[model samples]
Every structure is written in C-alpha cells, then in structure tokens.
Target: MAKSANPLPPRILRIIQRRRELGLTQEQLARMAGFSLSLMTKIERGAADPRHLAAERLLNLSRVLNLPFLHLVEDELPEEEAETPPLKVPLYPSLKEAQEKKTNVFVPLASPMIPLGATPDHLAFFPFPGPWLVGVGVPFLKQTGYLLVDLRPLYHPQGVMVVRFGEHAALVTAEDLTAPKGYLLSFSKGLPPLWPGDYNPELVGLVRKFLVDL
Candidate 1:
C-alpha cells in the first residue's frame, strides 16, 4: 500500500536545511526563535506539521534564521494576518473547569488534540474541550500541567502510561508490571506507591509532552 502524504504542508524544509548548513542545532534555533527545545525538534523533524503549528511560530523562526516568511510558510497566510486567530486547546484544572469556563488556562497550540482514548468524532463539536490535565511533581513536567496523554499509542511506542483500574488510576512503569500484584509507581522520591486493587488495569494512554507554565 502507498503511504499517505506528509502532513507538514507548509514545507519549512528549506529553512531547516539552511539552518543545518549554517551549523545550527535544533536547540540553538529554538533559543534564537524563543521557542521550546521540544517545539524546535518537532518542527525540524516534521512531527509538528503545518496544520499543527501556528503561523506566528514559523514567522518567529524565520526571523531568527534570516529567512523570508515565504520560505517557512508558502502554502497559507500567517496566522496573525488571518481574519481571526485560530482557536487553541485550553488546559483545565479538571473536566469541571472546562465545563464551567472558570479559571481554565488557554494554551496557544494550534492543533486539535484528542483525549487519550477518544475518537475524532468525540471532539468534532468541542475542538478544544480541555485536552491537557494539570498535574504536579510528575517527571519532566512543570508546575502547570502535562499533555502526557498520547492519543495514538501505536504511533508512539515509548513513554510512560496512565492506566485505569475500575474507578482508580495510577502511573506505572514496565518494571512495576512484573510484580504479582498491582503497585502504583511514583517517580517522586518521598511519595509511597499505592495498590489500587487486585484487578489488572487497562492501558489508557502514553504520556508525551509536559506543558510548562507559560
């Protein structure tokens, strides 16, 4: 079967190639553009495709690299130049925060992120109905929240997972699974592990990015 086309429609390939020609690393370009190192890696590697990134982000990188705006975004107009800015996913304290529309944080990402185990139709009506959940003291996560729920687990083979057993949930590792009984895994030094119950939990989602406080 033929593979589908790349989702990176805008073709910033020239900019990335040129940056490498100038002996610049993804980290350096990220610093130059005032973007996260992870964002830069995604852009360079084509993981953060055209539809997924805001035009402003590409423009910022173009400016830092001394490239023409067209070089980074030739397919569509810059987001700031659009009639209306695109809607971003909101980070909520919980599902209730999203429903109440009170004290919810708005993340400037330009992608339609679905929940860990939800379908595309599930988010068709409410595009940004709070994909990110706030959590504290998780490894590689800042104080704000973690976008750790990987919607496409098969696509991403690595990273930690959030599992659910009946009404309870816990973070567990591969080593933890080998135990005879359930043992909740906590990366924090002082926190003790909790055993939810005797039943084995199903794999919910893989943890990916940590949305830092912005």
Candidate 2:
C-alpha cells in the first residue's frame, strides 16, 4: 500500500470511525458542531491532531459522538495523575480581531464559571467597561464584564450583534444585511449609527450570553 500522507492517530481513527458509523459527512458534522468545514476535514483525515483541537471542540465532538470528555483528555494522562485542567475557552477583544487571530488570553472554565457553555471558536471577551456596551445600545448589559459570543458567521441570527469596523467594536441593531452596498447599523444614544457612506462593518459575533462577573 502507498504510504499515507498523514498517519492517523488512535483518537482520530476512533473519531472518524464513529463519524462513519453515524453516517455524518465532515461538512455535516462541522455545521452541526458550529465549526468550519475545513477544520473538520483536517481533523478527520488526520492532518491535525485531535488532542490539539481547542477544548470546547473536543467536548462538542465527544458529545456528538457519544464519547466521554474525560476519556479523551485522560488518554494522554499517566496512571498516577488522573486529574486534568478544566476545559478552557479563548478570550478576544472583538470579533474582528478574533478573525485576525488577535486574542488576549485563554480562560479556563473551572470552579464557579463552569456552567457557562461556550464554543471553542471565540468564547468570551476580556473584561471591558460597561459604558461601551451602553454605547452599543444594550443597556441591560451596562456593566464591565465578559461577553460570551458565537463567532461562527452566516449561521448567526440577525438582530443585536457585536460588530467592528476599522478600529471600533460595539453592539448594534443591524438590518438590511447583504445590500449591494452595506448593512444598516444603529447604535445606542452615545454612539452614531452607520449610514450608507459610513465604514462597512464586519460582524464579530452574535451575542450569546452576558457574563457579568469577572
């Protein structure tokens, strides 16, 4: 047999096997799991190691595959040390910067913060002042805190969204998306709404939940 370009890891093999048994194509699994099709292909074909995938991805994959999260993590753990760090998610300044791979840090979802279910793509924000959120028109979220966001584009529901342009990021009521020109962007009292000639905005995230505490 010709040598394989990418040797499949044991975990990758199992994951691919499970995907086949469930009759899910890579694109199907990627869409269902809220990730990119390209990434799903790389993982299933062993071009990427499953272990190195972000924590929430592994969790999502395990959940979809009917496998246990601990089992996947502990596969690399030695017998004497059974404990592993809690699953983690990354923090970014804005959805635009996140798309550019600019991030602040990774925060672990352990202890008190464990209940918030965030995807691996772009989880939460580094704590920003509530004033900015007010400017974005989300008065209810008017306090310095972390905001959980769904970074997957296209699949995002239209409405209150966090968006960025040039160098600014804020929450806005967006409509008329996909116009020949640009979307209609509105802001809170403190900020200006974007009109036709204004800077074209890029969607950073669809606001999922607000994390008021650190």
Candidate 3:
C-alpha cells in the first residue's frame, strides 16, 4: 500500500498544532479570531483553506498566539532591502501637547458599572455625554475604565450604525450592550455610537460622568 499523505497542508497543520500548544480549543481560537466555530473546525480539519477572510482570521489568531505574522506561510522568501523603521513617538511630549490642547484622555475599562457576560458574540454599547470611545480585544488591566465594544458578532454584520447626540453624532454597533466581565476600551481615534434604547440612559449617564472624572 502507498503511504498516506498528511491531511492538512504543512503550514495549516503547524498553525493547528501551535493553537493546541497554546491550550486553545478550535472554538476558542475561532472566537479569539472573530470566526465561527464551524469555520475554525473546518480549517483545522483540512476541509477548508484559510484564504481571504479566513486568512485574516488566521492573522488575528496569530496575534492572540503571540506568534510572528509570516510564520504560517509555507514558502519562505529571501529578504530584500530592509526598510527604515518609522520614527519613534515620544510619550511625555505627546502627553504634554495633548494636555495643552485640552484633549480627552481615554479611561480604561477596569470594572463594569454593570456586570455583563463576556462572550465573543456579545455587544457593549456605552453612551457618553460627549464623544464615545470603542476598542476591541481581550480586556487588559491597562485599559480599565472605557467602554468595550464586542466586535466578535460584528464580523459578519456589515453596515454602519449612527447615533446623534445634541450637536455631536457617533457611530456604534447595534448589539453593543452585551460584553463579558470587564469591558474593553482604548485610546484609538474615531467615535462609537450612543444609541438610544440599547442601554439604561440613566446608568450610562452615571458611568460616563464617572469615567470623565478619571
């Protein structure tokens, strides 16, 4: 009898093994990469190639695994000319400038004013008096007071949703009220929505005030 070939491609098999080494089940890896459980399982089982959107999913999984981005590629390419690195940003100088201009400092999500489930499909909507801040990824202690919008569900849901507040309007996810444990927030630009009926206006108002004071 002829020798049987390995089911998954070498690259993909390596990725699956790496995921296992990290003690992440296929479903867990899928959730982390914003992919569905079926899709993740298919990829691991060699029934599907993780190209295009699937490829992007793999990239996210690599980030969670703390592995190099290009490590999954089967063919190794020789290095060409090394490009110059981008200029380093000065933290103190940037902080001073932002302070002088009275810029809003983003507060991290430490403890949720309201406890919620932290599933990948849950959405967290945070309404503020002024602008809204949105961020993705697992909750890091450094980001402890801002609203965390769960993007896992939004991966398949397209179309931008907008919310108007007085003179300032913002865009937020439709299902933005369900988040797990402590919410996730960051200092990135762009505003999320303060949609009506999605949250308790009174509770949101109180949390907004508390975050601003921080």
Say which prediction, candidate 1 or candidate 2, comes out ahead on TM-score.
Answer: 2
Ranking by lDDT: 2, 1, 3
Best by lDDT: 2
**All models: lDDT?**
0.49, 0.57, 0.41
Tens-digit lDDT track of model 2 for 15-55: 77878899998888887766699989987776766778776
* Pick by TM-score: 2 or 3, better one: 2
- Kindly report which residue stretches of model 1 are placed more than 4 angstroms away from their true locations once superposed: 1-87, 94-106, 112-145, 151-157, 182-192
Q: Taking the candidates one at a time, how many backbone clashes does each contain?
A: 0, 0, 21
Model 1 lDDT, residue 194, Cα: 59
Best of the candidates, TM-score:
2
Candidate 2 residue pairs that clash: none
Q: Taking the tens digit of each residue's C-alpha lDDT, what string does model 3 give over 132-159? A: 3332322222333333333232321332
Candidate 2 has a TM-score of 0.40
- Location of the lowest summed lDDT over 10 successive residues in candidate 2: 130-139
Q: Which stretches of candidate 3 lie above 4 Å from their native place?
A: 1-7, 54-56, 75-214
Q: Using alpha carbons, what is the TM-score of model 3?
A: 0.36
